[model samples]
Target: MRRRKKKHEDEHMDESWLIPYADLLTLLLALFIVLYAASSVDAQKFKELSQAFNEVFTGGTGIMENPSPGETQPPSDGEVKSSGAEKEEKKEKADLDKEEIERQAFLKDQEELKEIQKKVNEYIKTNNLEVQFVTKLTDEGLLLTIRDNVLFDSGSAVVHSADLNVAKELSELLVMNPPRNIIISGHTDDVPIRNAEFDSNWELSVMRAVNFMKIILENQELNPQWFSAKGFGEFEPVGDNGTAEGRGLNRRVEVLILPRVTD
Candidate 1:
């Protein structure tokens, strides 16, 4: 029997829930990646990254016109040049300060030397020793000149007992200050020497310098290492040897106190 066609019910698909589940999984994965990336950001790099994003999204608008509190822009060329200029200026200022310090020290040394000169002149005048010894302050420093009559006799190297006391007193006064090079230069007249002790004026001058230096070294506290004894002989004679007066002036010993300076 041809029964009325049985009406079959349409089966409903249950896959509608799978679409929302896949979409949620995708959104969760993206959120986890963003959280991980944000967790590792530091201050400076994060600032720069924020600035880059702001510039990209601002579309050249008011948002990007002024930098935000946490945004850091790249260093401009002007800033870099200014930084270099500041360093160079600092170096130049340091050099100028050093030079000024040195200049002040030199001036102070000159003043001290001048005071010492005054004291020395006072002593010479008070003791009536001007005839044998003369002192003056020059650009070189304090100059103490001793004639041959006070230091030696003809070509003798031995210092008299009287001069020994003078040398000792000078050494004591000199040791009152810091150590410096003390140049002891000996000069003589051009006349030939005919003495048994010295064959020529050079030997006589050298021996006299040594003998005088020895007397000065009587002070145990004085440093002998700073002393220099040079025999200028007749070459550095202050006066001509042609006349007796000039020869007398030439026969002398000079003690030079050098000025303080840094090389």
Candidate 2:
């Protein structure tokens, strides 16, 4: 009897590992189900799912808040209002910052242009060129006006050899830290002309501007790409073309220095 009892005890197999095995199988099955559901889950639901898994694996304390895949708790009225106010405030602040930056840039450009104008003014004063040359700072940019006769002979497109030094000096002043665009425009009086070299005042004005621009660009430091020439003949006059004095003012060339930034 003793031998038979011992044999029966030895025949019993150890089944203690089956508990942990069963637990592992249950965890794996849960993992697969959660992964499958995650495919169609919304943003809120995915967040909740992530928290749920974290709590389970970490053995932390939290109520398993497994809401439906598409269901989400909306914010209260007060929260909605606060969020909107915050967004609007942020937008206004951003706009103000942008405007301030633009303002600073415009002011900086204006200051630089003013310095350039001062230099040109000094040159004009030293040379006693007040009657022939004038400078104005306008919203568009700096305007340097010269009587046509100062640079060109009457009814001629060619720049006078005597005034080549003037153009060269102006070109030297134009060299700056940051170069700006320059335009040389020509204007003519109302008197009509049909010369051998020019068909009309229009042709004369255009050639005069082009020739002046060429002289300015002869300075190796000046970029030809930044210089352009145009003509407005007897149409966009600064003075009346009816009188001789007014006509003298009307027949002029303008050197316009444009601002790098504008309002």
- The positional error of residue 172 in candidate 2, measured at the CA in angstroms, is 0.9
The candidate that achieves the highest lDDT relative to the unseen native structure: 2
Give the TM-score comparing model 2 with the true structure, all chains together. 0.76
- Compute the lDDT of residue 122 as modeled in candidate 2: 98
Q: Please give, for residues 67-160, the per-residue lDDT of candidate 2 as tens digits.
A: 5445555887999999999999999999999999999999999999999999999999999999999999999899999999999988998889
Per-model CA lDDT versus the true structure: 0.78, 0.88
Worst 10 residues of 2 by lDDT: 60-69
Which residue ranges in model 2 land beyond 4 Å of their true spot? 1-63
Give the per-residue lDDT digits (tens) of candidate 1, residues 41-152.
3545544544554565565454534545544456779999999999999999999999999999988988877877777777778778889888877778778898987867
* Estimated TM-score for each candidate: 0.69, 0.76
| Candidate 1 runs further than 4 Å off | 1-81
Q: Number of clashing residue pairs in every model?
A: 0, 0
| Candidate 1, pairs of clashing residues | none
